[model samples]
Target: MKRLRISLTAQIFLGLILGAAFGCFFPDFGSQLKPLGDAFIRMIKMIVVPLIFSTLVIGIAGTGDFKKLGRLGGKAIIWFEVASALALIVGLVVVNVLQPGVGVSLPAIGAAAGANAAATAQSFSISMHLLNIIPANIVEACVKSDMLQIIFFTCFFGVALAHIGEKGKIVVECCRGIAEAMFKVTHIQMNICCAKLFENYK
Candidate 1:
C-alpha cells in the first residue's frame, strides 16, 4: 500500500484512464464531478489569505531592518514587472504569428453589443488597475477576496508591526505561532483530502 501510494505518477495515470472511461460511459454523471474541482480551488483560496498575512507579519517583524525590507521589495517588484512584460510581449508575438482569430468566424454582433465590448475594454485603464490595489476597506477587500489588496494590507500591517520595535515582538511571536498552527492544520487537511480522493477513485 505504501509503495503504491508513493507511485503518484502511476496513480495519476491510472486515475486519468479510469476517469476517462467513466466519463465515456456515463457522461451525465461525470459532469457532476466539476463541483469537486471547484470546491478544491475555493478551499485553497480560503486558506491563502490568512496564511499569507500571518507569514508576512511574522517575517517582517522578525527582519529587524526596514531598509533591507524596502530594498527586497523593490527588487521583487522590478522582477515581477519585467516577467509580466516579457510574458505579455511573448503572448502578443505568438498570437500575431499564429493569427488564430483569422479563420475563426465569430457570431455577428449587433452594433450595440460591439459598442459595449469596446466600451468595456476602454474602461479598463492602467491607472484604474493600479488604484484598485489600494483597498477602500480592509473587510470589504477580504469579503471580495481580492488577493492583491490582501497582500498590500499584509505588507502594510507588517511594516507597522516592525516599526513598533519591542512591543511588536509579542504580536510577532503570536502571529508566528498562529501561522505554524494553520500550516499544520492545512497539511493535515490536505493529506486527509488526498487520501479520500484517491480512495474514492480506486
Candidate 2:
C-alpha cells in the first residue's frame, strides 16, 4: 500500500466543504457551534498582537531609516483609506443592485442587545481613536490588545532601537527570535484549527 499525503491547503479546503455540508444538513447543530467558532477566533487574536509587534519591530529596526519608515507608514495609511473607500462603494453598489434586504423579515433583537448596541455606537470618537493609537502606556495597550497602540509603540520602539546602532542589534535579534516562535505557534494553531472546526460541525 502507498501512503497518501494531504497538504494543509487541501485539508483546509476539505474542512470547508465538510463544514458547509454539515451546516446545511444540520443547521441547528451548526448554529450551536458558534461558541466554538468564536473561541477559535479568540485563539488567533491572542497570537496576532505579539506576532505583529515582533515582526514589525524587526522589520523597522532592520531598515534603520526613519525616512523609510515614515514613507511606509504614509503608504499604509493611504492604502487603508483607499481600500476602505472602495469596499464601502462596492458594498453599497452590491446592496443596491441585489436589494437583498427587501421583503426580508429579521427577528427583533432583545432590549438588552439594543441597549448594548447603542452604547457601542455612542463610544465612537475620531479624536479619541487617534489619541488611543499613541498609547499612554505600552503595557496597558498590550494588556488591552489594542492593535493600533501596539503598532504605534512598536514602530517608535523600533526607530529608537535603530538609533542606538550596535547596541540595538542584540534586541533586534531577540525580536527576530520572538517573531519566529510566534510563526511556529500560528502554524500549529492552523493545523489544529481546521480539525477543530470540522469536529465542532460534526
Candidate 3:
C-alpha cells in the first residue's frame, strides 16, 4: 500500500487533480507557474537531440546486417507513413469538432512574407531536402542541432563502421556508450521534472 501510494503514476494522478483544482480556484497563481513549465521544456530539448543522434548511430552500427537493416528500414518507413496519416486525420477531426481557433484573426501576408518565402523556397524542394541530408559541414549540423541531417550522416557513418569489421569496434563502442549515458541523463532529468511538478501541485 505504501509502495502504491508512492508510485510515479499515483503521484502524477494526484498532481493532475490538484493542479486542475488550483487552476480553477487561483488562475493568477497558476499563470505565475509558467516559468517552471518552460524550464522543463528547455531541459527536455537539451537532452533529446543528442539522445536521438547517439541512439541512431548505435542502432545502425550495432545491427551490422545490411539485409536486416534494409528490411527493418522499409517497415519503419511504411509505419511512419501510416502513423503520420492517422495523426493528420485525427487532428483534422478534432479541430473540426472543437473549432478551437475559429475566432482567431491574422494579418494578411506582406512584402516581408514574400522575402521570407523566397529565402526558404529551396528548403521545400524535394531534391534540395535530399541533398541536404549529406551535410557539407558536419560540425555546423551538430551545432545547429539539425536532427534529419544528423540522422542521415550518422546512418552512413554507422554503415561504414559496420563494413570495416573488427577494426571499427572501438568507434562503435564509443557511440554505444554515449547513447547509454544520454539515456541515463534523460531518465534522471525526467524524474527530476516530475518531482518538481509533484511538489508544485502540493
Candidate 4:
C-alpha cells in the first residue's frame, strides 16, 4: 500500500472549506487569526523583488546578445501590459459581481494623507509614469519596492553583465543560485501557510 498523502491542491481546497466552517462556528476566534492571513500575504510579497530581479537578470544575461535581448524585452513588455490589463478587467468584474466590501465601513484617513494623495494624482501623467521607470537611485528603487524601476535597472545591468564576459560569469552564477533559493523559499512558505490554515482543525 502506497503511503497515504494528500496533494497540495486538495490540501488547499480542504483548508478553505474547513476554514470557512471553523470561522462560522468560532467568529471571535477566527477574528484573531487575521494576522496569519496577513503574514502569509507579506511572506509572498517579500519574495517578489528578489525573485524577479534574480531570475530576470539571469535570463537576460544568458541571452548574451543585446539585439536578441531587446526583442525579448519588447515581447515581454507587450505581454506584461496585455496580461495586466486583462487581469485588471477580470478583477473589476469579479469584485463587482461579488461586492465583497459592499457592507464594510472604512475609517476616515487624515486630511494630510488625503491632500498628499490628491497632490500625487494631480502631478501624475502617462509620460511621468513611463519616465519614472528609470530610477535616479537604483538602491532606493529596490528598497521602496518600485518594481518597474527595478526591472528597468535589471535589464541594463544584465546587458552590462553579459558584455563583461569573464567577470560577469560569477554574477550570473550568483543570480542563478539566488533564483533557486527563492524558488525553494516560496515552496516552503506555501507549505507553512497550508499547515497554519489546517492547524485549527486539530
Find the candidate with the highest lDDT and give its number.
Answer: 4
Worst 10 residues of 1 by lDDT: 193-202
Per-residue C-alpha lDDT of model 4 across residues 1-202, encoded as one tens digit per residue: 3445666677778878877987999988888998997898899999999999999989888788878878987998899999999999999999999978888999999999999999999999999988988999988998899998999999889888998998997999999999999999988987777864333221
Give the least accurate 10-residue stretch of model 4, judged by summed lDDT. 193-202
- Per-prediction count of colliding residue pairs? 0, 0, 0, 0
Rank candidates by TM-score, best first.
3, 4, 2, 1
As a TM-score, model 4 comes out at 0.77
Give the C-alpha miss distance for residue 29 in model 2, angstroms.
1.6
Clashes of 1: 0
Write one digit per residue (lDDT tens) for candidate 1, span 1-202.
Answer: 2422334445456666876987899888878887875776677777777788788898777788888877877998899999999999999999999977787788899999999999999899999999999999999988888989988898888888888899989989988888898888776655544533334233
Itemize residue pairs with steric clashes in candidate 4: none
lDDT score for residue 106 of model 2: 94
- State residue 163's C-alpha deviation in candidate 2, in Å: 0.3
- Steric clash pairs (candidate 1): none
| Candidate achieving the largest TM-score | 3
Kindly indicate the candidate among 1 and 4 with the higher lDDT: 4
User: What C-alpha lDDT, on a 0 to 100 scale, does residue 95 get in candidate 3?
Assistant: 90
lDDT of 2 by residue, 1-202 (tens): 4545666777779878977987999999989988987888888888888899989888899887779878987998899999999999999999999988799899999999999999988997898778868988888988999888898898888989999999999999998999999889878877887763333221
> Cα RMSDs of all predictions?
4.8, 5.4, 4.0, 4.3
TM-score of every candidate: 0.69, 0.75, 0.81, 0.77
Can you tell me which runs of candidate 3 are displaced by over 4 Å?
9-26, 114-124, 196-202
Task: Give lDDT: candidate 4, residue 201.
Answer: 27
Please give, for residues 52-110, the per-residue lDDT of candidate 3 as tens digits: 76777677777888898889899999999999999999999999999887878977889
